[model samples]
Target: MFSGLPQDYSSITVTNDGWWPDTDVADFQSQRSIPASIKTETVASALLMAIGEANAELAAYQSAQRAKGFSSAKDVTGPSAGGVNQLCAQYLKIIFARAKAELMGEITSAEREKANPGQQSEDTRDRLLAEASFAIRNIMGHPRVTVDLI
Candidate 1:
């Protein structure tokens, strides 16, 4: 009677697997605890916003690059998008590191003066340098470029 329909329907099957295993849940929970301060929803929203902004910025940058006739190794070859992406990543790393260092140095100096009240604290310099190093590491580890193939 059902011959007029699809033959794959006869092979259809269903399984009740229920929820994920306890070990998987526990692992996920443990990982969640590590970044508990940054909620997944908030991170996701921020990432989406960042991606939108990055896309707009990339479009503008590429337009300028094209207008200026900026040619790279990838422009001559078709698959050089990776090279361009790497260049942008390197540039971002340098810029962010410099800015972070400068800003941290200024803030640390101001805070040290306020806290010490006429005496300079050597620890502040060490702490600020350490904090800046950590921030630079984080920024370097993060993906800074979104590459698109033209």
Candidate 2:
């Protein structure tokens, strides 16, 4: 199905912190529809960076869960979505969204100009960034928006 692609197409797993499950680079590419032009190393680097940022962002939440007697994300009890733990899915969402956003930013101005050859109004990077933020908040059991009356 994927002919003429230079990618390895093998399942290369990216190891995350012990609290979080490992991520598959191939899955990320498939889910994001990342173009073959993007190198595997670039995608792997982005995923690693995203994993680090995600771990840091959710450090407090993880700590809270641990304090509550939960050892890892899988230990949390909740309804599963798509047969996967909710929190685990949300965590993956955060990592995948952030990695995709970073990869979108990797597209140079010239590459964009050549690809579009016209004005493109949509900013996918921004949307992905927002998605990452939303997933982070969801996993933390925080409201997407917290407003205080001024």
Stretches off by above 4 angstroms in model 1 are 1-34, 63-85, 88-150
RMSD in Å for candidate 2, one decimal? 3.5
User: By summed lDDT, which 10 consecutive residues of candidate 2 come out lowest?
Assistant: 113-122
- Candidate 2, pairs of clashing residues: none
Q: How many backbone clashes does candidate 1 have?
A: 0
Which candidate should be chosen as best, given TM-score against the real structure? Answer: 2
Put down candidate 1 lDDT per residue, 75-118, tens digits, no spaces: 42222254444434433333333323333333345445346432
Tens digit of per-residue lDDT, candidate 2, span 1-150: 446756555478998777787999888988776655677788899999999999998999999998999988887889886667989988888999888878765544424745652222247777888999999988888899998999
Residue 8 Cα positional deviation in candidate 1, in Å, after optimal superposition: 42
| Residue 99, candidate 1: C-alpha displacement in angstroms | 16
**Segments of candidate 2 deviating more than 4 angstroms:** 1-8, 81-83, 107-122
